[model samples]
Target chain A: MSQADDLIHQPLRLKIMAALAAEKGAPLDFPRLKAITQATDGNLGSHLTTLEKAGYVAIEKDFVGKRPRTRAALTPLGRKAFRDHVAYLRAVVEAAEAL
Target chain B: MMSVSEHEARGALAEIEAVTRRGQTLKGYRYAGPILMVWGVIWFLGYLGMARLSPALWGWMWLALDGVGFAATLLLAAKAPAAAGGAAGQAMRTSLGMAAGVAFVLAIVAVFPKHDLLPYLALPGLFVGFIYTVLGIYLAPRYAWIGVTLFVATLAGYYAWPAHLAEWLAVVGGGGLFLSGVWLRSA
Candidate 1:
């Protein structure tokens, strides 16, 4: 069976990745992502940093007027990895069913 | 390899899809309510001017009023928080398409001079309705009914009361848009 993406295997990270990947070209602002994952600021920040370190997600920090804004987007690599992980999960489910 | 039971794997997949869908759903339609409501009011006021004043003069007056409304909408949008960004590109594309549509309609109207101005009046409502429908389908599903309502009301007005086309567009179409804004604001 294909291996799952370890970084995306965690529930919160998986949710974050799924949200970012869904929009493709559209970068999601930090508050919107937080609302989707229901994660606190610190927790979400750390996971996003981890994904950034892995090159799976790119975080852009900029200002909309005087206010600071942080937008998160799934990298091409991250999108591919997410698809692969989902495929691997499906394979595991199918294998178990066959057995 | 992360080993997991079939149930666990399936659950994770479902969870991911759910999160993705939630992310895609619109979260800030209220931000658009003020713009819609303001435009609707301007349309109604234009209708009144057209009824009381001459069509040639009122048309220019209405255009000026619409320009003000456009500026107001821009200010309102700028002041409102930005929760979404993808819709900006989509809106620009739709506006460009609608402008082309308006140009086509104007060209046709100019070529075939009809004594009845119903077609000219009806054309703008149709254009606005088309934009609303497109935006509703692509950005906000809640606006779908509003779009349909605008189309139906304007078209029906064209057929039923040709002379009162402006009235119908203002009372029914504009009113609907304003009400939609209220619904969005409260939603």
Candidate 2:
């Protein structure tokens, strides 16, 4: 049985992980993540920081021309965790359906 | 480990699926933007040539411009990362679709050889619009918007200003595509 990841279980955080995982390692910019998650800057930033601290996401800040851009990508561990979480969710649904 | 109710789990999974799909569509748009822009420029040039140059020169001009567009598309595809999920397969499918579209257009022209220049000019744009609309419906809503806009504009220009249809296509059809490409790239 797959185990649920508490840190990734939050609705917004799960959305963040899903978006990053979909990129297959390519970094997505902060604005793109904000769009996908539909979260405010502070909320998204805070969740990203949490994922960063948990070693599940890597955040990079860089300058493009004069503009500062922040991008996030799923770490290998994070990708595995996301897959496991998804599997757990599916298992839960399946178990319920089987009942 | 965290405990999630079946309802919560199902909802979370649904959200994840939606986000993942949106991410993939955005990524597809990013990859396709430059290619569309390249075609936009080609259309601009080709229509401009048709408007300005002799009727005999239009064919050669378009052929050359199309060659450039195809080469540019290939180069861009080559530069894109190979690991970007199904990049190669997508390219192959797109290439085949493009070729089939071209062949279908040619066959139509051959079968109906008596058509006026207006129909000939309108055919490509209409076909392109149809393709974009259908693909957009499946892939992204923005594409469908662009496609619909192109389709309506092409017909409007055909009826409203038949004399300057080529120039109108150059500006509206070509320019619309270029602008949409820029917009998609920013997404």
lDDT string for model 1 (B50-145, tens) is 667887695478558766876776666666434455444333343355446646765776688779777878877787787778867976777777
Candidate 1 residue pairs in clash (backbone atoms < 3 Å): none
Q: Which candidate is the best by lDDT?
A: 2
Predictions: Cα RMSD each: 7.7, 1.9
Off by over 4 Å in 1: A1-99, B1-24, B87-111
How well does each candidate reproduce the native contacts, as fnat? 0.71, 0.85
Clash pairs (backbone) in predicted model 2: none
TM-score of 1: 0.58
> In candidate 1 chain B, what residue range of length 10 has the lowest lDDT sum?
B86-95
Model 2: per-residue Cα lDDT over A1-99, one tens digit each? 999999999988999999999888889999989977889999999999999999999999999999999999999999999999999999999999999
- Tens digits of per-residue lDDT, candidate 1, A1-99, equal 678788888889999988887776578889888977889999999999999999989999999999999999988988888888888889988998899
In order, the Cα lDDT scores of the candidates are 0.76, 0.86
